[model samples]
Target: MRTAYRVETVRAAESALMARLPEGTLMNRAAAGLAAACAELLRPGLGRRTVARVVLLVGGGDNGGDALFAGARLARRGIGVNALLLAPDRAHPAGLAALRAAGGRGLAVADIAPGALTTLLGRASMVVDGITGIGGRGGLRPVAAELAERVTASGAPVIAVDLPSGVDADTGEVRGPVLPATLTVTFGTLKPGLLVDPARQHAGDVRLVDIGLRPLLPVEPDVAALTPAEVAALLPRPTGESDKYRRGVLGVAAGSARYPGAAVLTVGGALRGGVGAVRYAGPAHAAVIARHPETLVSPGTPAEAGRVQAWVAGPGLGDHPEAERVVNEVLAADVPLLLDADALRGLDPARVRARSAPTLLTPHAGEAAALLGVARERVESSRLTSVRELAERFGATVLLKGSTTLVADPAGPVLVNETGTPWLATAGSGDVLSGLAGGLLAAGLAARDAGAVAAHLHGLAGHAAPMPATASGVTDALPTAWQSLTG
Candidate 1:
């Protein structure tokens, strides 16, 4: 699992490690890693014929120190290194001295003309953003924001130190202007912002730099993403002794005459979700049967549907008058249940909380916002907070679907899914995801694992699908995604 810690946790671990080492040891380790990454980025362009130029955007605190030290290292390598000091008074004193000794130049941003700064940035091979560290919050200050704008205008590929300045290290919230990076070199361990969205989009590609702080860090991460190996371990595989019934049966209650395609897509996803049998119960049985004859289709409600290991409710059962009754019947069933799409409408928290069986909820940001009585914009901006709140409020596992899908249980670390492409945003995709997760639930994965694993596979399918992937295309690609993981 790729894990992330909060800023405070990372800081504590850093302090613990620093106490055991020499004064400058930790900074040197960070600087060395930063310089190495920068050098590697510059290598392809610098074919012995071209001279490499590096510009560091240095701010206050240890962040500035890291850039200055890294600049010194580049200067020693015969690379032209210049530092733009955002805070001349607060720049790391020793680090600045070292840069000067190594023939690196430092110019305060205040003293530089706008046109001259633009020219310098345009000529630079790479820009190192060390403007703010984890401690800095609420976005960049005015002077720094202007500089960031200029740097972006230059179109230089940037390598951020730790994280892009202006993004919240703990919350992943970008309140004001942010300097997006081509790559981010984070020290010690990953931060929540690096893994979560809004802030994640700004962080192009993330590289973790281990500075001997792992051993000192806490065992539990604030957030985590499942690696392929870990996901494979969690996936259910049938043994020789396993029969159709022994493997598991998933009951799906979805679709209406108005939107029967939802049922077809949902059933398609369930069939590839490692389940033995898919028992589909709803109004769209004929449509589902036509598409997937293997499905045990029934026109009756979910309760009348034969014994099932788990149930998936909602997904386009739009105002059929009996839709609520079907949802209630599925909710009342003593089996693991996943709620999605139309089934999530007017959902009662009390009903979900009272359920004896495990409950999982998959809601897009708008649905999530409605459930939490918050604005959709709020949920989108603060994804982590919104998902966690929904999980806690409903007392159920929540899979909030977006650019970075998050699966969170009532408690414990939230799981972030990074496998998906933006193309997964096509319509009826959530229905496919709902059926996929429901099948996992039937296959005996815990609510959290089922939701997370389903998201992982769903994302992979999105990638495996043809470009401009449709919901049906994603469903068709599930087997390929499954094999890619299990293989």
Candidate 2:
């Protein structure tokens, strides 16, 4: 699993590590890695020693020190190096001296003319952004912003030190103009901004440099993405001694006469998911039978759907008396339940909170907004915070679906799904996801694991299918996704 920590946590870890190290040990190790990374970005013809010129946007703190020291290393190797200091008065004295001694040119950013800056930036092989450190908040200074604009206009590949300036290291918010790097060389550990969206978009490719601070970091990280091996271990496999009943049964209450295709799609996902049998209870029996002949169809509501290890409710179920009854019956059951789509509308937040059984709420931005009584825009802007709030409020595992699928519970690190393409944003995708996750729940996984694993597999299936894959295609690829984990 890949873990990300907040800015404060990173700072605390850095402080603890620096106390035991020699004065220049950490900075030297960081500079070596940064220089090596920048050199790799310089392609075929532009030789590092003879032709490449790496421009460093030096600021006033540790980030600037990193850039200056890296510039010194490159200068010693005969590469042309120029350090443009945004705050010359406050620049690290030791760093500046080292760069000059190694034949690197140093200049004040304010002193450079537009024509000169543009000309210089245009000829550069690569740009290193060190205008701000993790502790600095908000956007870049005016002079620094202008230099960034010049570099952007130049169309040169940029290597950012630590993180791209102007991004919130803790929240991944980019409110003002900031330099976007083609590659970012971060030190010690990964920051939250490098993983989450908005800021993540600006951080093109990230490479972590070991300043040897891992032992100093806290045991619990803020956010994480599950590894395939971990997911493989979490998944349950049937033994020869296990029967159909032992493998588990998933009960589904979904679809209406208005949208019968939803029931077929939901059942398609459940059948391919790791479950022994699927007991489907809805108004779309004919459609369900036509698609999946093996489904155990119920003549009445889910209340009379017989025994099930877990229940998946909602997805295209229209607002009506019967649909409400199905939702209420499932909620009252002691078995684990997954609520999605139209079921969200029928649920009372108070009742959902009072449920003793494991409940998982899968909602898109709109449904989540309605439940929280906040605007969809607010939820989109702060996805991490919004998911946590939803989980705490409902006292259930909440999966917020988007470009980045996030599953949050009342405790532990929020799991982010780092898979899927924009193509997965199709009709009825959520229905397939709800069924897949529900099946995992029936297979004995907890609410959080079910949601995260379902999302991860759902995304992989989308990619495994042909380009421009539909909801049905994603469902068809479920077996391939599961095999990828097992095999």
Candidate 3:
């Protein structure tokens, strides 16, 4: 797992590291790493004698100091480096002196004309953005904002010092215009903003500049990006003594007369997800059996769907009162359950918390907003917090799906799914995810692991599917995804 530390935690770690190291040692290390990365980007064409023209958008904090020192290194390598200081007076004194000594020129943001700035930005091969850091609030000041706007319009490759300007390092929220960087050289630790969406979109490629803060860190991590090795470790492996029943049974309560296809798709996802058996109990039994002959169709309610290790409730159930009734029964079953689609509406936050079994709630932004009694925009702006709040309120594992799918348990670390393609945004995708997660739960995985594993597999399946197709395409690609995982 790739862990992301909070901004405050990163700050504390940095402070601790600085205290142990000699003065200017941390900044020098950061600058050295930054310069090396930039040089790598310019290799073959632009050799050791750096003839490339570089532009730096310097801000006030140590972030600007990082850029200025890097600029000095570039200048020493024969690169023509220019620093556009946004806060000239507040800029790091040591960084400024280093840049001047190394033949790097500095100018105030107001000193450059609009056309001149645009022309220079367009001509430059790389632009280093140090306009803000994790300590910044809101958007950039007018002058810095204008510079960013121009730089963006120029279409030049940008290297963000710590994170993209205008992006909240802690929350991944982008309030105003931000300079989209081709690469982001972050120091000490990975911030949550670089891993989450909106802000992630701006951080093109992330590179960590190690300043020896690992020993000073407290705790492990709150959020993490699952790697292949981590996902493999979490996946359930069959044993020689295990029978079909021993592997696990997944009870699927989905589909209705109005949306029978949802049942088939959900069952497909469950079967593909390696569940031992899929017991289908819903109004669309015929449709499900027709599509998947392997699924055991039952005519009874969810409670009477026989003994199931886990239950997947409410995919395409519509607004039927019976769907709500099924959800309530599943909640009372004392078996792990994955609640999705129409089932989400049936849940009363207070009642959901009363359940004895572990519950995993999968909700899109709109559904999450309803659960939280807040606007969808609010949920989107702070997805991490919103998902955590949902988990806490309902006493369940919550998987808030979107560009960045976040899975949070009531009292555990949050897992952010970052491998999904935009094509997975199609209809019925969530149904597939619900079924897959339920299948994992039936296989005896923890609620959080089940949800996160399913999300990871679903994302890989989406990526494996043909582009410009429906979510059904992603469902069809599940076999390949599974093969890639197990193979």
Candidate 4:
């Protein structure tokens, strides 16, 4: 798993490490990593090793110090380095001296003629962004923002010295104009901004640079990204002695006459996921059987869907009274539950709190807005806060889906999955996700783990499918996705 911490946590760790080391040691480590990464980018293919041109956008803080020192390293290796100081008067004197000693030239932002900065940026192979870090507020300062805009328009590859400028290190919020980097060489620990969205989107590719502060850090991460191997470890594998009942049964209550396809898609997702047996109950039995001959379709209510280890409800079924009845009945059952789609309608927060079994709620922005009694825009603007609020309010695991899908539990660490392509936004995709999550839950995973693992698998399936998989195509791709994991 790739872990990320809040900026304050990183700062504390950095301070502790700095106290033990000699002066400027941490900065040197950061500079050395940055210079090495830049060198790799410069030497793409064959050719004689000659001087490569690089431009550094220098700011007023230690962030600028990092860039200046890195520029010196590049200069010493036969690379032409130029530092365009945004705050020339407040530039790091020692770092500037080091750059000059290594045959690097410094230019004030004012020294560059009109349009010259863009011209120079266009010719350079890479640009180093050192405009702001954890000390930044709001957005880029006017001069800095303008320079970033010009450089970005130049279409040159950018390597951010630390965290990208104008991005909130703590919240991953981007309030103003920000320069997007092709790669970001972060120092110490990963910042929350590099993992969460808006800012995460701007952070093209993230590379962590250890500055010898690992021992001083806390274990609880602000954010985490799960890899395939880590996800595989969490999955349930059946033993030779395990029977169908021992493996666990997943009860699915979805679909209605109005949207029978929802039921088919949900069951399709569950059957293809790693569940032992799937029992379906609802008005869409015929449709379910038609799409998935393997499904054991029964004419019963959700409560009568036999003994299931877990139950998934609320895809389609509209706002019908019977659908609400099904939701109420399932909540009273002994098994864990995953609620989605129309099942979220008219949901009383108090009722959700009274449930005994672990419950996982999956809601798109609009559905989450209805549950929170807030505007959809509000939920979208602050997804992390919204997901947390939903989890606390409903007393359940909440998975808020979008560009950066967030899964939060009342008592566990929040997880954000950033693996899906935009093509996964097709219709019935969410139903498949709901079923996959329910399958994991039935397989004895915790509600939080079930939601996260299902999301990760769903994304991988979408990526594995033939380019631009339709909703049906995503369902078809689930078997491959599951096999890839089990194998």
lDDT of 1 by residue, 7-54 (tens): 999998988888999999999999999999999988965422267889
Q: Kindly indicate the candidate among 3 and 4 with the higher TM-score.
A: 3
lDDT to native, each model = 0.93, 0.88, 0.86, 0.86
Instruction: Output the number of the lDDT-best candidate.
Output: 1
- How does each model score on TM-score? 0.98, 0.96, 0.97, 0.96
Question: RMSD in Å for candidate 2, one decimal?
Answer: 1.8
Candidate achieving higher lDDT, 2 or 3: 2
Q: For model 4, what is the alpha-carbon lDDT of residue 338?
A: 93
Evaluated against the true structure, the overall lDDT of model 2 is 0.88
Candidate number achieving the greatest TM-score relative to the actual structure: 1
User: Which 10 consecutive residues of model 4 have the lowest summed lDDT?
Assistant: 44-53
Q: After superposition, which runs of candidate 1 have C-alpha atoms over 4 Å from their true positions?
A: 44-49
Q: Candidate 4 — which residues are off by over 4 angstroms?
A: 44-51
Identify the runs in model 3 with alpha carbons over 4 angstroms from their true place: 44-51
164-194, model 2: which lDDT tens digit per residue? 9888888777777889999999999888888
Native-to-model Cα distance after best TM-score fit, residue 386 in candidate 2, in Å: 0.9
Per-residue lDDT tens digits of candidate 4, residues 1-487? 7778876888888888888889999999999999988888889452122447899999989999999999999999888889999989999898999999999988999889967877788777789998887767677878888899898888778898778898888777778888899999998888777877778889899898988877877887877777788788888788999887788899999999999999998988887657799999999999999878888888678877788999999998787778878898888888899999988987888888888899999999999999999999878767777888999999999999987888998865688886777889989999999998999899899999898888888887898888777778888887777778779
Sort every candidate by lDDT, greatest first: 1, 2, 3, 4
